[model samples]
Each structure stands twice: as C-alpha cells, then as structure tokens.
Target: MTTSAMETAVEVEQRYGFDLIDLETVRYGLIEIAREMNDTLTRGSFSPLARDIRDCTSAVHMRTENGWEMLASHEGCVQHAFTSPHIVNFTMSEWDESTLREGDVILVNDPWRGAIHFSDLNVLQPIFVDGRLEFVLHSTSHVADLGGPIPGGFANGAQTTFEEQLKIPPTLLYAGGVAVRPVFNHLLENNRTPNLLLGDVRALAGSLSVGASRLNSLFERYGLGHVRASGEYAMDLAEAAMRRGIATVPDGDYVITDSLDEDAIVAEEITLQMTLKVRGDSMEIDYSGSSRQPAGNVGTAWIESTRAIIGTKFILDPASPVNSGTLRPIEALLPPGSIVCVLPPSSCSSHTETGSRVVNMMTQALSEAMGARGIACDTGTSGVAVIGGVDERPGHEGSPWGSFAVPGGGWGGTWTSDGVSACIVSIAANCRSAVNEHVERESPLVIWEHELMPDSAGAGMHRGGAGAIFTIGAVSTTVITITGDRSRSGAPGSSGGGRGMPFYGWLLRGDGSGSTLDPRRAIGAEPLFGVFDENGEPDPDKGTFGLGTTYMGGKVSQLVLQPGDGIRLIVGGGGGWGDPLERDTERVLTDIDDGLVSESFAHAAYGVVLDASGAVDEDATAMRRRDLARLRDQNKWSVPTACPPAWNTATIMEVAS
Candidate 1:
C-alpha cells in the first residue's frame, strides 16, 4: 500500500479500536484457519475421492450487509470456490438469518442451489460469537455413490436429473448440536455405500466444528470486531487488485467457442461459446451463443461463473485472495437453460466435462487479448474414469467396490516456457491423478501401463506438454464409465503453432488386439455392448450381434469387461504457443531424448535434421526449416478460426501415422 493509503488505514483502524498491523495478521490467520479445516476434512474422510484425491473444498465466510462474503478459501477445485456462497445465499434467502443457530449444520446437493451435481454434497455451519452471527464455515466433497440406477452418480445415458441420483436441498443435518436422525438416515438409505457416505459427511461436519473452534480462538485473541473487519478488508483489497488486473487488459471484446465430443446419450455435438468483455476496470463474461441443453448427463449450472473467475485469476490476477471481492469486478451473463446454465430436470452428473471446457474457452479468449502475456489451450478434459463392481476378494465376496480415477492430461505452453506434462486438468487447482497402487488396492483392477505419450504435444517454439496413457486390466468382471472430451479435435494452438493430438480410448481384447473407441457413441449396443462377438468371443472386427465394436465414445456408459480384458485411455496434449518450425533445434532434440517427441516428429514438425551420430545437423536443419516454411505458405496452412485441429499436415497426427 502507498504511504498515504497506509496513513488512512491507520486512522480507520484507530477509529475502530483496531491495530493496522493486525489486519495483515488477521488476513493470513483466516487463510491458515481454512487450511486447517481442509486438512481436518481430508484426514477424517473415508471415501478415496476425498481422502486420496482430495476432491473437496473448504472456505471461511464472514457475514456482511451483502450476505455471506467469501474471506478465505484453500487452493482447491475452482468449481467449488463459489459453491459455498451460492449455498449460503440460497439458505439465507430461504430462511431469515435469525433462524440460523449455532451448532446447526445445513446440508444440500441440489445443482440449482449451488452444487455441481448430486454426487457432491455441501455442508454449511453458521458461527456465532456471543449469540451474534459473525462467520460461516463451508465444506463440500464427492462421495462414493448416491443411490442411482448407475453405480456411480454419473449416469451418462440419463436424459433427466431424476435418473442421475438423489437431490437434497438445504436441510438441517444437525440442529442444536445434535445429529438429525431423519436427515442422516435418509441419506444413508439412499446411498449404495452408506457406511462410507456417513463417514464423509461426518468428516465434513467435523471439519466445520474444527473451523468453528479455530475461528473462535482467533476471535478470543483479537476482538471479534477486529477479526471480522480484517476479513472484510482482505476482500476489499482483493477486489481492488482484481480491478487493477482487469484494467491491464486492453478494452475490447474477446470471444472463443469450444465443444464437447458428445452428450453421453446421443452423438450430436455440444458446443459452448464464451466472450470476455473488458472495459476500464471491470469485465463481463457472456455465455450467450452456447448450445441448448442436451439429453445427456454432461451439463452444468452456477459453475459457469465459477470457471469464469478461475480463468480470470489464472490468466491475470492469480496472486489475489479468492473471495467475493475478487469476483466483484466480473459480471457473468449466463443465458438460463443454456448448457452452461441448465434448468430443472436437466442431468448434470458429469458437469465437469462441460465445466472444464468453459475454463479453456475463457483462457483462449483472454490469452488472445493479452498478446504475449498469454498461453495456449490445455488438454481441456477432466479425464475422469469411474469404475465399479462387486468385490470378489477373499472375505469380501459380494461386497461392492468403486474407484474414481482422474488421469490428468497436459497443460498448454506459454511464451517463456513449455507446458507441464502429465498433470491434472487446469480447472482442478490441487487435484491429483489416481495412483496406480491406490487404484489396484481399491478395485479388482491392475494398472498395466502409465506412461507419457510420444509426439503428443503441439509443436511450437515452446512445445505444449505431452499427455499420458493409462491402461488397466480387470481381474474380475468390471464395469467402467469414462467421461472426457477433445477426442476428435485436439487442444488448439496459437500464433501459427501446430495443434496437439486428440484424445482416444481403446478396448483391449483377450487376444491382445485393440479396438478403437468411436468418440461419438454413448455406449456400445445392447446384448454384447460391442465387446463380444455373436458367439460371445472377442472379435477383431465386431462385437456380439454383428454390432460394430468400438462404438463407445469419450463419454461412455457401463461397458462390461471380462477377465483378462482391459481399457486404455490416451489423454491429448496441450496446445503450443508459437510457430513449430521456429523451435530451437536443441529443444527438439531434448524432447526426442526425453521420449516426449519422436525423431520423426522433430523432422516433420520442427523441421530439425539429425545426422547418424544423433546430433543436430545445423546447416541442413536451417535449409529444411526454410523449405518447410515455403511449403506451409504455398499450401495456405493456417490454424482454423472456429474449428478444432485437423488431421492434416499441420498437426502432430501426421507424424503419429
């Protein structure tokens, strides 16, 4: 802060009988408290999704004249950063603030009321000091199962939300420091894994108690008014920082359009368009020209705004504190009933599929507007695979088991550095991929291969990160449901760079042969599901009943796998930032040595020539690059404005072939 500003802050602190130094202490103290709450939830949770992958969010909110305002949120899922506010706002609007009491916890999972899907449950606790409401603690986590026809909550073939799973609005799970038996028992009866779900809920609730205790300690040390004002001041600072960041971008409208491979129910393409409008110190994200809701599970609501703020922070003001104030400068214009903002009865079990694409679209538009201070697109898929079945292990026969794996992909390249390889998707802030050991221990599946793909990254001056390949073999009969995108069209590159390869899935047969998955089918046909022949044997050309094998797509339904059968997922690479031929020869050689790029790709995409000794032939490389440039100009090779990367000479697909 400036000297004059510091003086004013001191005066304000004196007027409130607070210390100016305590503002910074209280600011960081709230964040530390949030982290403690997150650690408590993760340590106490039972589900692997929460305990292992940490697919949950924790935050501390202070009550303001404008309702609950986010003060401190741990680095976690960008989707859930705003879910707390949405739930708090909904709860206060439904019931008067005076109706809320200490030791009472509100539970909700309705997507329209701040949840991403039915699988994610949110718990809210109101913290009262001296019988006056001062703050609220919020936590959310994904559970193993919520009694639906499908094993996991993601019912890819479902046409409506009712088919997805149970929907719980804001209801009291705890009242007067006691568990609400009816509400507690109702959730258990509806979930397949009742024991685990109960444990997770208790963990979330327990974490809130932990937060309440810690926050109370802070209030006990520094007066409640000073502590509360510190949180509000933190938010005000974030708002100012965000506004300054927005002002840095040139005033104009930046727009980009992205698409999903298919809605898991049908083969129709689902498209989403996003526009970033910046003027002065404020911005507006408009999701107006998006496709209508489809008859499938890949839909999202409220999360559109969440992804917008995430995108803005990631590209411009990532250092600012994530609170209501940081989101104050941005206005989100989401057309109701659009894919980005679905209405009632629309299934959103796999909303992350669309939510990830929203962030990618925003990144592309904002990066383009920022010129050199930008990055290309990432793999753009959550790369989530839900596998479940009956446990046939010793002493656990007939028991149900499920595994949720997020085999993350590559990140986009930037002007100064190459993208990160084999990392979690961009939308997930601190999520991790499922470890091979954990996957094997949780389910009856053995991970066979987990390696980086060669020649997968988009070629450029700084190449995009390479993706990964994950293959697993089923020891017992297993059913798998995969949700992903960027199958047909890979992550798009920028500034004349080559596009990254697209994602693909394959069914490994008993005979060691593989059948490619069609990136348009929800699932294979019935009777055999395109995995077995008419005689119930693995067929090279087709599955049972003469139905073509490999009919399932990126977003698939229940595909049964026999023993010795396996599935492989090839996550696409991130997009490059600049021209491929302009890449340094040594970097190209380094990529080849590191097994990220093939020797053929170096020659084809980077136009780099290596002699017999595996060293760069400098003179020949310069001539080759010149010739490649001439050919590119003659062929009018340019990145498409509105389409995905093509399988032509400009992409990495050529070298792969």
Candidate 2:
C-alpha cells in the first residue's frame, strides 16, 4: 500500500502490457508468413497431395529458453519444429552460424538427422535483421512421390530406412540468395513428379522470404531489443495461460490405455498406456508401462510421442500457449526401445500411429479426471495413403501419378455435441483427400463413389459423425500400396457412447468377384481396389481391366474405364456423447431432420417413442425412458455398456463366428 510499492506495481503492469501487445503483433507477422507459405505451396506445387490434398505445414521460430520457440499461428506437423524442438536445435547447431546471410536456406529430410521422414521435405531460412539472426522461417510438405520403393514413400514393408526415400541432412539448399540448381536438379531427377517438386520447393522458399521480410519490417518499426523482448513475452504469456488452464482441473492421478490395430510393418498389435498425475497446477504423463519399440526402428520415441499428445491438448485449448513453457507441467517416462521411445536405427516411418494412440489415451485419461471438460475421441486414425502407378494415355506421355486418398471414419461424441463425420483425425488435421474429378483426370483411375455410410457412427444421446465410402479403379497397368491403421479394431467411444465402425480394404475382380486385401499390403497390376462399406459392399463397379495392369495395353480398353471397375474408400464416424435416452427430444428431432440420425435410432436410442405420423409422443417417450431407467438401475448402471448394444451384435457375432 506504500507509494513506492504502488509505483513498482504500476511500472510492472505497464511494462508487461506493452510487451504482451508487441509479442502478439510479432506473432501475427509470423502467422502471415505461414499462411503465405501454405498458399504458395497450394498454388505452385505440381503434386496432387500438395496442391489438392494440401498435406503441408509452415512455422516461424525465435530463440527461447527451450532453444527455439515456435511462433503462434503455425500448423505443427508430425516431425517439424513444432512437435520436435530438439530437432530444430540440432539442425541449427550443425549449421554453426551465429549470423546468417540474407539469402541462406537449408533443406533437410533425414529422419535420423532431425527430420520426420524422406517423404516430408523441410526448408528453413534464417531471417537476419541488420546483420543479426532475428527469426527462423520453416516449411514442410508431403510430396506425392519421393522416389522410394513405393509411389507415395509409405513403404510399409520397407526393411531399411534407405528404401523409404532420398535422405538429406543439413544441406544448404540455397546460398547467397540463389537457388542451388545442382542440388535442385538432383532432387528432381530422383522423384517421379519433378515439375511439381520444383514448383513446391520454390513456393516454400518464397514463403520463407516473405516471413524474413516481415520480420525485418517489424524490427525497423520497433527496435530489435523490443522485438526480442516481445518473443520472450509471448512465451511468458503462454506459460501463464497454460498454468491457468491446468489449475482449473482438480488435481489427481488418472490413467488410461489404448492400442494400435497392429504395427503395419509387423503384424502384431501394440498397446499405448499412460498414467497422468496432476498436481496443483501441473501434470505429468508417464508411459513407462507402454509397449516397447517394435523389433526394428519402426515406431516413435516416448518423449516425442508424449510431446505430440501434449501438443494436441494445447492445440485444442489454444488459450494455453503451445511452447516448452506450457510443457513444463508435463513429464513422460518410457523405457528406452519402448514403442513410445524407440531408439536410433528403428524405422519410424509410422511413428505418427503411436503418437495418435497416445493422444487418444491421454485425452481419455484427462476426461476421466475432469469429466465433461474433455473433448471426445476423434475417429481413431487417418486411414493411410494408397499411392499407385499412373496409367498411360496414348497421346499423353505415360508418367507415374498417385492418389493420397483418406478414408473417413467415426469421431468420439462429446458431452455437448456429436462428432464430425467423414473427416481426417488429429495427426493429419490439415491434410484432406483429393477430389475425385481432379484425381481421375490427372491419374489413370476411376473414382466410383464418395458418399456417407449411414448408421456407421456410434449411437448415444448425441450420435457420432458418419463415415464415408469411396471407390477407384486402375485405368492402366499400375502398382498400389497402402499405409494406415484401424483395420483390426474400431475407434472407441466415451461415456455412454457407442463405438465407431472399423476401416476395411479389398480388391475387386472384373466378374463382380472380390478378394480381401490386408490393410498394409502393397500390390502390383491390380485391376480395382478401394474401401468397403459397413456391410462389406463394394462401390458400384466401373471400367474394365487390361493385361499387365497397364490401362494402355490391348484388351485393357487402354486401362480407361469401359465403365465398370473402380476403387472404394470409406471413412469412419465419430462416437456419440452421454446416454441416448438422456438426449433432449428437440435435439433428437433436429438430428432426424438433418438426415444425420434415423427415426429408428431416435426411438431405440433416445427413447423418443414416435407415432405413425413421425411425431414424438412425449408421454409415451417419457414412459419408455422411465421403464428403461428402472431396468438400468436394476442392472447397476454405471459403465457405458449399461445400455443395450448399439449395432446388431447378434448378426456380427454370427458372421465372425
């Protein structure tokens, strides 16, 4: 209360407020750069995945307590600076330069050397303001073809890391503000889509240049000291925000376990377990008892996996800043060589699978601790990319092209709402499936159907989102490969919600006959392959097959559709929230009208008894629910299974048996 104390307090508030504003402004500048980078890639990239599928990420970095701090507004990719800060630091250290030249750019894609994989190309450029390293701009993208054993670089059976794709370390991609033509040429020559790669790389460079220019402008407007101080302020603000969010949840220890359908490379299922111990305003997640790494280097490390889970939580709650400071409250322990913490020489091309499971497990655990405050589980996995060879057209030069198609699946229903249908889940949030029209025109394939699979979502008070079904067929002789999860088991639901549908793949023959395909299998010269419906139905057939899998050969109809063969893709639905009977009548009616929920579902699940006129009989519904409640109480209702099975369990059991 003294004058001196009051004066000190006023000065602190004023300084902090000023720094906070400056920090936000700088963060926006960085975001602008990231957006530009994304746009540049979308516009310039020649590959279907980059231009159409949009599988890429961009970020800006400044020095911080954790080595390099990721600026707000950047989409964090699996192995980029956002998820792997240590990798960025390692790259920067290897460069060993305090001051960076104006035109300097570095490219790296070595998973063993701070990069995610050879499929993902990373380009980093340091922004120097007045001859000092001020900021780092980086971008990452999933190139359609990277000259790997497989067309899409997702070699599920890849025995060695070298077979995955071209590996690059901390190589100088650009020096003195000029493109390294030799290096660029080397990369282009090794890939199937040279024109696309070259264009996308330039786009990345352009994005970095824009970010550097922005940083310089900010420095010119505000002193360098202020800019640097602002970066620190951003971290401080994020730390404070995260602490506040954590403090809201009651402190306690909670644990949950989940598993991968199976390791794609090795045909064994693996579990990911976590015990979250939350103290006053901090928490730690331990994966000590989780499954160890696969026999080979085929998974991700525990620390990185844990970081990814934490990253998902942070992203969902943006109020909590995403940085090392926010992660201070979280700790993870995984035995070395465990699936969660694989050591070197391990093939980690599929590390994202473990990371996704970790996210699901962590979220499930936190939901148990905090009840309804947690979001529902997403559709368990992002179905893998099915890349194959391009069929040749007579007049058009034959070249290889592929589709990075994503199957849709169920999302976990939340406390207040149903899950989003037909969407990719957490790990690849920014990537999307290519449109059929564009895909077929560019590649030698025919897309059959892209429709929603009804009743595939788990039922509850609020039903989960619906899954999707898509089909495609080879127009010529081509090779195909698939890499993803959720074929063995479906995504689990929460509370009283029903489990979502599982994913499946198959190959269809010319005579309406079909054979099941393993989710991880790579095939050559297949006529037709696609996702199946919940009832195991294939998309309407289209086109005809030719010899040798090439659409161009005789009796092949040039591999172009004579109109009856195709590939199909099906996405899963999200889970529902709460008990169906507990859902409000109005909400149930709304869902019925929206075509998301069926009339039978409304009555069976929500207990909303309806008359012949499709009108809800309030009194009848109330009476039905009362009886259901009595039955539930008699059975000691508590777990999600307290209610009747959501799907036709009898039929499913009979089929399986």
Candidate 3:
C-alpha cells in the first residue's frame, strides 16, 4: 500500500462525522453481504427453528478505534441489528482480537458477557486483509438444544447459571480452518440433540466464511482506505437520521411501569419500569425501579437489553436503517443486579417471555410520544412446548425422538389497522411459527388443530389480533414441558380499549372412555373484554387450564403423558390501541361475519348492534354509539378498579364427539 493512501485513510478516520465519498454504494454492498450470509444460514441449518422459522441473524462490521461499527445486517430481528454490533465490540475486548487468525472462529454464549441468552449462540470470524484483520463477520442462531432442564432450553426452573444450559464462553471452535476436536466433543456430549446443534454450528460458520469472502472482494474493489471511510460515512448518515427521529418525540420525562404475570415459582408478580427522557436530539432510558434479578432464569443480559428502547426510535422513524449511526442518539441505564442486568449465577436462559415484557412496557411508555406510531403490545410469550419420547422404531438410535415448537401469537393493534393474528411479535422481526407439516413429519406428534381462537382479541377502534390454539395428539407416551406466559395478565388495551382474553393450557388425558372437554369454556360470549367462568362472572385465574396432571408452575415444567393424549395450548392475544366504541360500525359487522368478533362483543364493546339476520342494525348501533360517546364525555374512562375471577357467559367451547 502507498504511504499517501495510508495517510488519506487516517485523515478520513479522524474527520469521522460525515461521508467523504459516495457511501450509498458502500452501504448497498455491505447490506448485500449481510443478506447473503442470512441466506446461507437459513438454507444450511437443520432445525425448523433456524431454517423454517428464521430465528437467526447475521452482520458484517468495520473495526473502529473504540468498537466495531455496524456496516449492515440481514433483514432479520431489528434488535439484533442494534445489539449484535455492540456484542462484537465486547467480544473483541474480552478475547483480545490481536491474537485472532484466519479460519479461526470464536464462539460465545455467556449471557453476562454479550449473548442475549445461552441458547442464542454467536459465531464470530475475523476477516483478515493484507496480513491485517480489519473487519469481522458475525452470525447468531437460536440453536434447538443446549442441554437445559427441558428438551428446548426454555428451562423455566433454571434458578442459577449451572441449571440454565451449557454456557460456551468465548472460545476457539475452529483453528486454522480445522474443527477443535476437544471443544466440539464437549458440545456433543453435553447437548441431548447434538446432531441438530452440529448442523446449526456448521451453518453459522459457513455464513461467517461467506460474509468474509464477500467483504474481501469489497476491499479489493474499493481499497481498504475507501472501504473504511465508507463505513464511517454510513454510520454518520444513520446517526443523523436517528437524532432527527429522537427530536420528534417531544422533550419530556415519560415514565411507565408494568408487572409480569406471576407464576407458581415467583408467587408475586415482578414489576419492570422504564423512565424515558427525551431531550433535544438524544434520549435516555432509566430502568432504576425494575425488580431485582430473580432466582429463576427470568433475568436479562445487560449488554444489549435495550431492544425496546432502540425499537421505539425505529417505531417513530420506520424508514431509518439499523446501523451504528442509528444507535448513537440513545443511552440505556440498567443498574447492576436489576432484572435487566444480572450478575453471575443469575439465570438468563428463560428470558424470552421476560424480555418480551420489557419490550412491551417500553413501547407502552412511548405510546404517549408517538400516539399513532406507538402500537399496542403483542402476545409477549414465545409459547414454547417441548415434547420428547422414546423412538422405538426398529432402527432407532437408542435416543428419544424430540421436537419443539415456539408457536407465534397475535400482534398488537395500530391506529390505522387491526393487529396481526398468529405471528411472532414485533420485536422478533421476521420470525414466525415453524410449519406444522415439517413438525409432524420429523416426530411422532401430530397436530390435529392449529387455528385462531375466535373473539380473543382486545377490543378497540382498531381491534387487536386474535390468539391461536394448538392441539397436538401424541402417537405414544411422551414427556412434555411448556415455557410460556400471558395467562396471568393477558395483553392490556390502551385509551379505553378493552383487554384481551387470558390464555389456557389443558391436557385431554385420552382416558379411552372418549368423553372430551369443552375447548372454549374460558371465554365468554362477549370475549373481547375479559375471560369468564362457567356461570357468567369474569374469571381472573390464569391457571384455570392447569388441571389433569399438567404443570402450572412458574415456567410450566415437565409432565409425563400417554398415547392418545392431546395437549392444548392457547396462545394469548394482542393489546388494542383505542376505545372500541370508536370503531366503525361497518367494520364491526365485518368482524362478526368473519367470526373474529361475536355479536355480543359487537354490542358490548364496539357499540355496534347486530340484528337477528346477523346484519348491522344502523339505528340501534347509532343510538348505542351515541350513549358510549356520552359516557366518554362524562369522564367514565378514568376510574380504575380491582377485579377477581368469574365465569364465561359465552359457550364457545366445543365438546369433542
């Protein structure tokens, strides 16, 4: 390289506030590298979780003086885009990047360090150019198993680091393009499903290598000097845009707090609070009042726990790209020993449901800032059900056939449209439910029904999405574990909107006598507002479906079952945006026809009266709406009260024949 060229690169780096060249092409090329890496991982992985559900992400970064600057990331989870680069920076310091070599891959899953959880493994590869490592490629995937308390790593009872799952700290998984036998063997011996993990690791490694190859070509084309300059330019562009987005939120200190639905293990509901301070072009989120870290694995990783905080800026400016620049205008404050920032021995494995609550409450607090853009929260649980049993096939490998499903729930409502049903929540980005056909083909479990729960959405001007019900029939005796939430404090609505129905989980017992149970007994005829009991009063017990040998503990751990037995898991619904009475009468009639909203709900929540013919009663609906408007004028929405469990008036539950 020429001395003049080196001097030019240094000068460009020093004046790092804006682009010195045409950075648009540089940005496009970086994005292409990220997308290519994503394609490789999605195509190469074995598990339905990584390949089909897309619970993975990849990124390419430029090493900066202080940390790695995110050039681009795959169009996957937005949270990963913001947090993964910082993780890469953390890894650099932890392992001392100067010793990294070509073809060597670094693996990290220490939650206290930078990983979101133990299950989300990260594979890092150093990209060396001209005998110098200038950039790095990263790939993160939610591997199927890591030998936790359950088949899936949703170990609800994991109270300490030792119980959660295998935690692989920063280590050399590969050296000089060869697999480290001892490290690989250790992973295989510990994990129950080693084959799947091996495939996933291979996929991650391949993606990293591919990203390096692509980035190398970019270096050859643009030269290392221009390439580094371009990255700095792109970061500056994104930072400027992020600051502008922050400026729009109106300078003020907005504070809000919400409680997690209590489980048997944590008898008392834990509270998470966020105080967002928006001033000028930057924002600060103080989580000072959050509950202390729990004995269970419900704690969060401190390094990148601001998916909610950063997500809000994106929520306000949907067009902004997620890069190093986008993260510049915000600071997150999670004190040590708090729920959002845990220390050693504090479990972070069973963190998805808990993390979702953090994201939801943050979104709720910011709703006042961007009222229309502040959409309601989704069914915040991953709705995991891990099933395993002996595979007694003639040539079985002496191990049980096991497969798990992280079922997606409903997404919250927005000002312009109703919520999305049966999907992974907003924070998850592009992830969704793994195909059922693939699940049945891979294991002995057969899904009889996977459908939307009728009238399960929170009622509002733009009604929230309805939840889903999964009924799986096991062909043989098996052991199952469920790690989920939202049954306790079902998704809450806002601005006078009605809350969604709580979730339900049941086991058929398959007693052979063939008498079946009512599937929808928990929901009333008017299911929009709340769940009800058999007689007619509202029911508030989140564990009504915890009978018949099922587990309803903190994380809903293990239960042994028999052939012909069916497992029923009801995923919760999303929260609504505004008052249901403000909803259009025509839209309510349409919902009635579509079976999403019941006639009773139409009358009670939306103030839309339907005639005997199932058509809208225009005059009656008008009068009902007028009365609701009058109530609103009389300040009826401000009064709040305590409630208890009651019965459902609607007999929506179907008795099996």
Candidate 4:
C-alpha cells in the first residue's frame, strides 16, 4: 500500500462530483439511523448485559465492489461494530442472493467467519431497494449462556473450541419476516437461560427491523444515486484523513513484547510480540513472533487484527470517523495458530482477554513512535466477572440467573491530565459499567464494597487514575468465572512515568474458618494482606501473594462460591505520564485532601515533605527532591520492571516466607 492510493480532499470531491452540503447531510442522517438502531436494541433488550452494561453494538454496512464496508456504526463495543464488515462479507460469499433476501435475518458467531468470540451473537439483516440488495444492518450482543461446560462462554480452562460451546454458523434465524421455528427452538434448548436467549435474539432482530425502515426513509428523501454517492464520498474523505494522520508519524520500525500471567490451563506464560513498520503514510503490524496457540481458550482468530486498526485510530486519529476507508492504509500479518490468529480446534472463549493485551501492545508501540502526542498505557484487562446460578427471588424461584459484570479499570494518563478512574477499556467504546443495584436485583448477591483504592494510581506529574476494590457476596451457591489480566505485570508507563499496581483477586470462605483461597493455592488456604501495609506500602515481611507464581486468579472457570462467601478484586490502575518529581506541589496536596494519594506515597514517590499543619514544607521538600533526583541520576534508583511471572513453586514459597 502507498499514499498514492489515497486521494486528497479536493481530488475526492472532484471524483465523486456530489454537492458537499448534501454529502454532509447524508452522513449525519446515517449516523442518526445507527444511533436509533442502538437505542432500539438497548430499550428492547431483556438481559442485563445488553440492557444495563450496553455490551451490544449496531452498525450499517453498504455493498461495495470489493465487498461490504461499514458506513456508520453505533459507537459501542468498537471491536464488534468495526469488525462487522468482515462477517457480512463472509456470509454473503457463503450464501448468494438466492439465500439472502428482503425481510430475512441471518445469525452467525463463528470466530473463523469474523467474530469477537462465540458469545457475541451477530444478527444481520439484508436491505433491498428497487429489487437490488444495497445494505446490511447488524446488531451484536453477548448472549448469557450457550450450552457449555460453564454458563458463560468465557471458559478459561477449555482446551478446544468444542468445549467453548455451540458454534452457530450463518443460519436463517428469521426468514421472510417470520421466525424459523426449528432453528430458534434448537438455539433456545442449547442455552441454560432460554428466556434470556429468546428475549435478546428478538431484541437484535427488532433493532435491525427499525434500521431497515429508517434506511428506506433516507433513500426516499434523497434519491438512490445521491444517497449512494454520498456514502462513497464519506468513505473517501475518511481515507484521506487517515492517510494524513499516518503521514505525521516519523517513519521507523517499532517493536514491543508483552505477556499474560498464564493460560488458566497452563502455568506457563503466553508471550505476544509485535513489530510495527511505518513507511510513508502506511503502517504494517507483524505478529508472527507471538506464542503458539495455548491449551486454554485465550487464543483468537483473524478478528484480532482489528485491534491493531483500533489502536491506530485511538492513538493517531481518534476524531476521524470509523469506516472501511480508515483501515485502508494499514496492514496486519498474523501467523496462523499464533495466539492472535488461532487455527481450528483451538478455543477462543477468552479472546477478549488476549484481545485487550494486543490493544495495549499497540498503544505502547504507537506512543513510542509518536513521542509527545503519545498517551500512557491503561489497565490492560476488561475486568469481566460472570456469575451464574439459580434465582431464589420471589416469583422467580428455581429459574436460572446470570450476572455479567464489567467493573472496568482505570485509564492511563494523557500528556495534559490524569486518566479517568473506573472507565471502560479502550476497545469497548461507550459501553457502561455494570450497576450494583441492578446486579443485586437480578441475582442473589450483595455488592458489599465498591470504591476507589486510594494511593493506587502511578505517581507522575500527571498521575494515572486510581484503581478500584470490588467485593460481591453470594446469597447461595453459585458458579463464577473470572477472565481478567494484568496481575503478573502492571500497565507500563511511558518516558519517566511509573507503572501502575498489578491486579489481585481472592475468594473468601464463608465457613467461619477465616480462610481465603488464592488462585495459585490448591490447599492450605490462608488469609493474608496480599499487597498493602498500614500506610499503603508493600509490607517488607509479606510479599504480594496473588501475583507471579503465587497468583493464578486472572483466569478461572466454574469456581463455586457458597452462601456468605464473597469474591474480592483489587483492579489494577493505569500507567502514569511524565516524571513524579516534576508534579505540581499544589496538585499533590489536592490529591492528599481527596484521599487519592497518601502522605507516605507523596513522601516516598514524589519526595514531598508535609508539615504537621498538613501543608508543604518548602525547604525540606526542595532538599528531599534534590536528593531523590541525584540518586536517580546516578542510577541508584530505577522504575519497577513489568516482567512475566516465571518463578518455580519453591521460589514462590521462599518469597512468601
């Protein structure tokens, strides 16, 4: 690919030969249509994942000579909406015009055919105008339970795709404006929560129906030729804008390697390597050096490449519209069977876990390439907790209930300001965090504790957001699955900034034994203050317990929690930007007043001295900062290394002792 392939704004205008005002009007109209589709889905949804958490995404794709390309999308679950074109193209290729028609809805979730994972059920409806198929409306939602060993499809212990759950190919979920009884019945029977599946599937179909009607209105208002030409012009404009963004970066080859703590089934770490090559106005991402498909379900298919595109958009040109043209100047080379591009039989139930890792890696590489315009790394995990069991609530006794909670982590700091606290991951655009009251109402559980962990953010001139502590207690026996990451290593900071704290999880016993179960311990569970002292520092006597070889809680499957038992999570904070010593003293005082930064952390990390009056001591603080800077300049102090957990069992025990 070359810059010549992209045209200038003037050239695009001349080629399309359409009124600029009309094009802009059509573009906004399409955006309105997409937003309407999104509103329809969420309003009509039944499951909390769709209704409350807003885990679903909707988009509009138009037919092109090469294939289908996205026109406009509801800005939620960015990966899902951006990747819809691939699945639409694939399905259209598999079944021609004979199989697809007006008033018909197609369903598919095969990762090989372009899907985020098995749990993301895709519903596509083909739009026909004047006897020609012109567009496809898409809606995707994470269905609750799809008949697997575990209730939710994020199976951390699965070794094969079959173990993940039922894989639905492109099938006619609704044909000719009517439901396919056999297909619908079979899908409902295969799921643990039939009511949820029934309602969610209908909701997706309903959203598509609304989109079709609105699209017809768009074409009717502006004749077919103008509408079609306007969409093409919109895409061309986006491509040119994207090319301009890429042209700003200094051309070079940037490389980065990172690892997940472990594939739940294997204690060994899973390494991911990437080499980004920039030439002129084009970029190429080569992931041929990543680890082979692991025994667990963390491996993903080709859809993982989209994360690289997403990274490009977020880092370089976030304001640019998301369309097929924005991806024209970028290319990704993913080796088959690698963690990023898994082959057949390899499970992908935990694709989101590894997918987020890819996004983080891309951020690190792109930020290094862009220099001052770069942003620090955010908490690299989505922090998804899936809990399922029978509902004992009044009027719903014996019915199965599932809770998909996304208590997202803190965001990394930018050049100008601190990161946002408890925000959703980068890939999940516009998705909301799970509400505690809603979760409790839907299930037999209590959210006992949910708050920001003070002094958790990385220290810098502009610090990262504070991480959070979440504790959920079960009212009865229930199955839990946690697919998260960033425990072995924290989110790496850029330049001289400090890395954030790692994630920690524990299962507290309700048997009055005061025993806590760490993921790394199979027996002899003991309660310990895993990562904090009286003043929020690492206890010299007690090393971090749920980390490295002693921690395997990042990914767990089918773990049972009894009545009165609770699950606690100390979510990791984001990486900081700039040097800690350079931070404003007044800002540090404000952080102290807000309880975001502790007095000890200010003294230790920032070299700031506070007097008994809770005010900065000018002379002592200046001296302390000078001494700390001298030590750092002489290489006597160094930032913590974000490395993999590769210790042996004996070494882990020695560290614990």
lDDT by residue for model 4 over 322-439, one digit each (tens)? Answer: 8777878888899998999989888888877787788888888888998866777788888788899986666878888888877777777778898888776778857877788988
Better structure of 1 and 4 per lDDT: 4
What does candidate 2's lDDT look like per residue over 1-657, in tens digits? 101212343453466545444556765665566677667666767777667767776776787656776664355343343454545666787887754587899988776555665778888888776676757777778777678666656566554566567778888899878988889988989887776678778877776777677667777887777766666655555556666667777788887877765554454567777887878766777777778777533466433533445533542355544544445555666677777766666666655556656766766776677776555566666666555664466655467666667665656777767777777666666556687788777777766566666555766776777776556666666565544455444566667665565554434444433222221121211422222223323211121111122121100101223223444444456656667778788877877777656676566556788788877889999998888777778994422311112322122212222
Query: Is candidate 3 or 4 superior in lDDT?
Result: 4
> What overall lDDT, based on C-alpha atoms, would model 4 receive against the true structure?
0.77
For residues 340-372, write the lDDT of model 3, one tens digit per residue.
Answer: 887888877776766677777766777777676
Once fitted onto the true fold, the runs of candidate 3 whose alpha carbons sit more than 4 angstroms away are 1-22, 393-397, 512-518, 521-554, 628-657
Model 2 stretches astray by more than 4 angstroms:
1-23, 76-81, 98-100, 295-298, 302-307, 310-316, 319-328, 512-564, 599-604, 607-609, 617-657
TM-score of each: 0.90, 0.83, 0.89, 0.92
Candidate lDDT values, in order? 0.76, 0.60, 0.71, 0.77
User: How do the candidates rank by lDDT, highest first?
Assistant: 4, 1, 3, 2
Which window of 10 residues has the lowest lDDT sum in candidate 4? 642-651
Residue range 105-182, candidate 1, lDDT tens digits: 988888888777888888989898899877889999888888887666778888887787888888999997799999
**Comparing 3 and 4 by TM-score, which wins?**
4
- Name the best candidate (by lDDT): 4
Q: Cα RMSDs of all predictions?
A: 5.9, 7.4, 5.3, 4.6
Worst 10 residues of 2 by lDDT: 550-559
Q: What is the lDDT of candidate 1?
A: 0.76
